[model samples]
Target: MKIFLAQQNYHIGNFESNTEKICCAIDLAKKDGADLIVFSELSVCGYPPRDFLEFNDFINKCNEAIDIIRKHADTIGVIVGAPDRNTVKEGKDLFNAAYFLYNKEIKGIAHKTCLPTYDVFDEYRYFEPAYHWNVIEFKGKKLAITICEDIWNLGDNPLYRICPMDKLMEQQPDLMINISASPFDYTHEQDRKAIIKANVVKYKLPMFYCNGVGSQTEIVFDGASLVFDKNANLCGQLPMFQSKLEGFVLNDDGSIDGPIITQAKDVPDTDLNPIGLDEHLNIADIHDALVMGIKDYFGKMGFSKAILGSSGGIDSAVTLALACTALGSENVRAILMPSQYSTGHSVSDAEQLSKNLNNPYDIVPIKNIYDSFLSELKPIFKDLPFSLAEENIQSRSRGNLLMAIANKFGYILLNTSNKSELATGYGTLYGDMAGGIGVLGDCYKMQVYALAAYINRDKEIIPTNIITKAPSAELRPGQKDADSLPDYAILDKILYQYIERRQGPNEIKAQGFDAALVDRVLKMVNLNEYKRNQFCPIIRVSPKAFGVGRRVPIVGKYLS
Candidate 1:
C-alpha cells in the first residue's frame, strides 16, 4: 500500500482556504498513485480553534468542510481531523475525531481518547474522551488511527489511564497512523520521535505520523512528520518548518520499502529542561522557529510591514535581524530612538546594523519629547528627586514616537523585551513593553546573545559591538541592567527552575542557588504576573511561556 503524508500550514477559522489546501494535496497524492493520504489533526478548521469551538456555526462550518473534502476521496483513502458532534448528550458536546473517507463516503471514524489539558492544551474543556475504540480497515489493511495525544500515553508514568493503541490491538491491526498538531519547543522534536518509536516497538506495527506546520499566534507547529518500520527503524521523515507531501510504500510483510532516513536513538530520561544558559544548545532550531513565527503572524493577519525600536542592545538587535529575515529587509523599518542618556555609539551601532541588513531606518531622538513630558509634570511634583518616573518618561517617549510612526506607515510594532526582563518586572508598562507582538519574550538574555551569534554565523549581520556591549535600557544616565537585577547567568537558571520546572523557592534554593536570591527572584516573578498579564502576545519557543499556558494569579500572595 502506498501512503502519503501531508504536512501543511493551516489558517484558523479559514474554512475555504483550509479546504482548498486539503483538496489540492489529495489531488497531488492521487496523481502520484497513493492509496491513502493523511492530514494533521484539526486540519478542517485549524488546530486550537479555542473558544471558536463553542459556536454552533463554527462546528457547522467544520462539518460543511468535511462534506466538501469527502467528495474528493473517491479514488484514494483520506484521513483528516475535525470535531464530531456528540448526540449521546452525556459529556462534552463534541469529540476530537479522525474521519476515514473512502469511496466518496464516510468509511469509518476514530475518536481521540486522550484529551490533553496541560501546558498550552485545553482539549478536555471542549472535547469528550472516546468511550469506545476500534481500528479502521481500508484496502485489506487494518489501520489503527489515533490523534496527537492518544499515542503519548506509552511511558511508564502515563498521563492517561487508557491507551488507544492497546485497545485497538484487540482486532490485531496491521498498521498505526496518528495525526497531530503538536506545537514546537527546542526539545520536542527528539521527544516526539522517541515516543513514536516506542509505540512502534510496543505494537510491532509500522507507524506513520503526520504533524501540521505553521504558527497560530503564540504556538508554532513544526511539521517534521515521521514513518517507522515494524522494527522501530525510522524509514522516512519530513522536513522541519516546511509544508511537504511525501509518499512511502508499505509492504505487506510489515516493512517499509525505503532506505532508513534516520536511526532511532534512546529517549532522554528527563523531562524537557533548559539546562542553564547554554547558548549553542538547539540555537538553530530556535532561530528557525522565531523566524517562522514572525512570518506567519504577519502573513495570516494581513500585515505586510513591521516596525521596531532598534536599540543597540542584544534583545532589539536580534529582533531586528529576525524581522528583516522574515519580512524582507524592505518591509521591516527600524526607528532609532536615542534619548539624552543614550551614548553616541548606541546610535552608530543601530545604524550599522540596518546598513548590514540593507533595511531602511531613521534616527528619531526622544530627548525633546522626554523634556516636554517632564515640563508638564513638574508643576504637580515640585522638588521630587530623579527616580524611575524620569527614566520611564524617556522610555515611554521612545515608545510613543515609534507607535506614531508605525501608525502613520501601516507597520506593526514589535516588542524586543527578552524573557529575563519580563520575568523580573524590569520592563516599564507601555514603554518598552508596547507592541503588537513580543519577539524575544520567551527567550532569555543568554538565548538572545546566542541568536545574535547564529545570525552572524555566515556573515556579519549584527554589528560585533552590539553583541559585546554591556546591556542597558539607556533610560537613566549610565544605567545597567545589573543595577536592579542579578546577573543573567544566575538569574535565568533560577527562573527556569521556578517557571519551567515548577520548582518552589525551597526546591530551587536546594539546588545550590542562594536562598536569599531565590526568594527575591521568585517574589519578582510572582509580583510581575500582573504586568505580564497585560503585555502583548509573546512568540512562544519555550515549554512554559508566559501567555495562556502559564496561569498565575495577579492578587494572590504565594511567595510575594
Candidate 2:
C-alpha cells in the first residue's frame, strides 16, 4: 500500500485555513495514487491550542474542520488529529484523538495515551488519557496508529508506565503510523531520529511518522518527518521549517518498497546506518530557526512592518539582519538613537550596516532627550552621584524615541537584549527591553556573535566593525558590559548550568565556578523574575527559553 505524509504548516483556531490546507493535501495524495495520507497531531485545530480547548465553540470548529477533511477521504484514507468530546460523566471533557476516515466515514480513532505536563506543555489539563487500544484493519493489512506522545513512552526508562506500541504489537500489525506535532529545539532533531529508530527496532515493524511545520506563536514545529523500515533504516525524511508532501510504497513485509521520494530529491533506499542521522547541533540551524520564528510571528499575527533600535552591537546587528531577511529589507526599519557617550564608530558602524543590508534607518540622537530627563530630575538627585540613575536615562530616552516611531507608523519594535544581560538584570526595564517581540532574548551573547559570523559567511551582511567592536550599552563614558558582569565566556557557562540544567548554587560551584560569584549571578537571575515576567514574548530556539516554558514566581524568594 502507498502512504503519503502530509507535513504541512497549520494555523491554530483558523478552521477555514486549516480545512483548506488539509483538503488540498488529501487531493494531492489521491492524485499521486496513494492509499493513505497522514497528518500531524491536532492538524484539525493546530497543536497546543492552550485555553481555546476550554471553549465548546472552539471544539465545534475543530469538528467542522474534520468533517471537511472527512469528505475528501472517500478516494484515499486520511489520518488526522483532532479533539474529540468525551461522552462519559467522569474524566476530562476531551480526549486528544486521531480520526481515520475512508469511504466517507470514520474508520478508526486513536486517543493520545501520554499527556505531557512538563515545560511548554499542559496537555494533562485538557486531555483524558486513552484507556483502550486497538488496531485498524485496512486493505490487506493491520495498522497500529498512535498520536504524538503515545509512542514516546517506549524506551529503557520510559516516562510512562505502559508502552502503547507494546500493546499494539500484540495485534500483530503490518505497519505503524505516528502523527506528531513535536516542537523544535536545536538538539531535538537527533533525539527525534533516535526515538523513531528505537520504536522500529523494538516493534520490528516499519513506521511512518508525520509532524507539523511552522511556528505557533512562541513554539515552532520543524516538520522533519521520517519513514523507518523494520530494520531501523530511515527510508524517507522530509525537510525542516517548511511544508512537504511525499509518498512511499510499503511492502507487506513491513519495509518501504522503493527509493524514498521527496518533493526536492530522492534518497537512496540503501541500508541506513544509525549514525547517519546523528547530526550535531550547529549555529546554522539556530539561525534558520530564528528566521522562521520571526517570519511566522509576524505573518501569523498580521504584522507587516518591524522597527528596532540598532545599537551597532553584535546583538542588534544580528537581529537587524535576521529581521531584514524574514520581513524583507523594505519592511524593516531601524532607529539609531545615539547618546552623549556613544562612540563615533557606533553610529558610523550602524549606518554602514544598514547600507550593507539596504534597510531604511534614521538617526535619532538621544543626547537632547537625556539632558531633558536629567534636567528635570536634577533637583531630587542633587546628592546622588553619576550612577545607574543617570545611566538609565539614556536608555529610557532611546526607548521612547523607538516606541514613538513604532506607534506613529505601523511597526512592532523588535527587542535586542541577549540572554546574558537578561539573566543578570543588566538591562534597564522598558528601555532596551521595550519591544513587541524579543528577537535574541533566548540566544546567549556569544551565540549572537556566532550568528553574526554565520550571516557574513557568504557575504558581509553585518559590518566587520560591529562584530569586532567591544560590546557595550554606551550609557556612560567608557562603559563596557564586562565592568558589571563577568566575561560572557565564563558567565554563559554558569547560566547554562543554572538556567538550562537547573543546578543550584552549590551544584554549579562544583563545576569549577567560584562559590561567591555563582551565588551573586544566581541571585541576580532570581531577583529579576519581575522584569522577565513583564518582558515581551521571546522567540524560543533553545531547550529552555524565558517564556512559558521556564516559569518562576515573580514575587517568591527562592534564591534571592
Candidate 3:
C-alpha cells in the first residue's frame, strides 16, 4: 500500500482558494501512484474557524465544499478532515470528522473522538465527540483513523483517559492513521513523536501522522508528518512549515521505500522524544515558529510594511529581529522617542540594535512633547501625588509617536510587550498597548530573553547588555522590574500554573512555593484585567492568552 501525505497551508475562511489547494494535492497524489492521500485536519474549512462556526452559512458552505470535493471520488481515494453537522441531540451541534471518498462513494467517515477545550481550542463549545467505534477495512487491512487531539491523551493530568487509540487497537488494525491540526508549542513535537512511537512499538503496527501547516493569528501549525514502522523507527518525514506532498510505498514483504521530512534543522532534539519546553527554554524552535508565524501573518493578512517602537529594551530588540526576518529589513521600520526620563543608553541601544538588524530607523525626541504636557498640567494637579499618571504620560507619548508614524506611513504598529508584563499590569494601556498587532504578546518575559539568545546563536545581533541587564520600562529613574515584581524564573512558573493551567492561589500554593508571594502575584494578576482588556491585538502562543481566554471583570473584587 502506498500512502500520500499533503502537508499544505490553508486560509482561515477562504473556502474557494483552500478547496483549490486540496484538489491540486489530490491530483498530485494520483500522479505519484499512491493508494490514498491524507490531508491535514480541517483542510476543507481551515483549522480554526473561530467565530465563523457560529454562522449557519459557514456550516452550509463547508457542506457545499464537501459536495464539490465529491466530484473527484471516482478518480482517486481521498481522506479529508472537515466539519459536519451533528445529528445527535444533547451535545454540540457540529462534528470534527474525516471522510474517506473513493469510487464515487463516501466509503467511511470517522468523527473525531476527542475534542480539546484548553488554550487556543474550545472544541466542546462548538463540536461534539464521535461516539461510534470504527475501523475501516482498506486494501485487506483494518485501519483506525483519528484526528489531532484524538491521540494527544498525554497531559499533566493522567487520571482521565480520553483517546480510544487503545479501543481501535483492539480491532487489530495493521496501520493507524491520525490527522492533526495541532499548533506549535515550543516542545510539543517531541511529546507528540513519543506517543506515536509508543503506539507503534506497543501495537506492532505502522503509524502515520498527517498534520497541518500555516499561521492563523499567532498560532503556527508546522506540518512535520511522520511514519513509524512497527519497530518504532521513523520511516518518513515531510516539510515542517510549507506545503508539500510525499509518498511512501509499503510492499507485501513490509519493505518501506520513501524519504521522510529530513531531520535537517541544525537545532538539536527535534526528534519525537520526551523533553520539557516552556517559556524561555525552547528558543530555537520558538524562533523558527515566530519567524514563520510573523511572515505568514503579514503575508496572509495583506499587510506589507510594519512599524514598531524601538525601546532599546530586550523585548523590542527581539521583536524587531523577528520582524526583520519575517517582513524584510526594508519593510520594517523602527522609531525612537526619548522622553525626559529616557536614558542616553536606551537611545544609543535602540540605534545599535537597528544597525545590527540592518533596518532603517527614525528618531523623534519626546522632550518637547513631555515638557509641553507637564507645563500645562502642573497647575491643575497642584500638590497632588504624581502616581501612575506620570509614568503613563511617558508611555502615551511614545505610543502616540509610533501611532503617528504608522498613520503617516500606512504601516501597522507591531506591539512588543510580553505575557509576563501584560499578565501583571506592568504595561501602560494605550501607551505601549497602542498598536495594530502584537508580535510577542503570547510570549513571556523570560521567553523574550531566550529568543534574543537564540537569534545570536551564530553571531551577536542583540546586544549582550540587553540580555544580561534587568528589565525596566525606564519611565521612572533607575527602576528595575524586580522593584515591582519577582524574578521571571519564579514569576513565569507561577504564571504558567495560574494563567495556562487556571490554578488559583490555593492550587498554586499546594504545588510548593511561597504562599505570601503567590498571594501578591495573584492580587496583581487579578487587579490588572482592565489594562489587558484595553490592549491591542495579542498574538497568542500559549493555551490561555489575555484576549479571550483569560477574561476577568475590570471592576471585580479581590479573589483572595
Number of backbone collisions per candidate? 0, 0, 5
lDDT of 1: 0.92
Please provide, for model 1 over 1-560, each residue's C-alpha lDDT reduced to its tens digit, 9 standing for 90 to 100: 99999999999999999999999999999999999999999999999999999999999999999999999999999999999999899899999999999999998888999999999999999999999999888999999999999999987799989998989999999999999999999878888887888888789999999999999989999899999989888898899999999999999998889687666554333345555546567899999999999999999999999999988888988999999999999999999989889999999999999999999999988878888888999998679999998988887888888899999999999999999999999998988999999999999898898999999999999999998888998888898999999999899989988887898898888899999999999999999999999999998888889998989999998999
Candidate 3 lDDT over 1-560, as tens digits, reads: 88888888898888998889888888877887878888889989897887788899998888788777777656677888888788778588888989888876778889887787766777878888888868888778677898887776644554235557777877877788898898876656676677776566567777788999988876788888888765566778776777778888765544466553333222222243222226555567677777888888888889899989897899999999999998999899999887767778888988999998899999998888877888899999777876778888888988888888888888988989898898888888888887777788888887888788789989989988778777888877877889989998999888888877777789889888799999988888888888888887676565567885566788888663
Query: Which lDDT tens digits does candidate 2 get at residues 368-447?
Result: 87888888988898877799988988888888888999999989999999888888898989888899888899888888
Report model 3's TM-score to 2 decimal places: 0.89
Comparing 1 with 2 on lDDT, the higher-scoring candidate is: 1
**Top lDDT hit:** 1
Candidate 1 at 152: error in angstroms? Answer: 0.7
Candidate 1, superposed: residue stretches over 4 Å from native: 265-277
In candidate 3, list every pair of residues with a backbone clash.
119-543, 236-260, 237-260, 237-261, 238-261
Give the Cα lDDT of each candidate: 0.92, 0.87, 0.80
Best by TM-score: 1
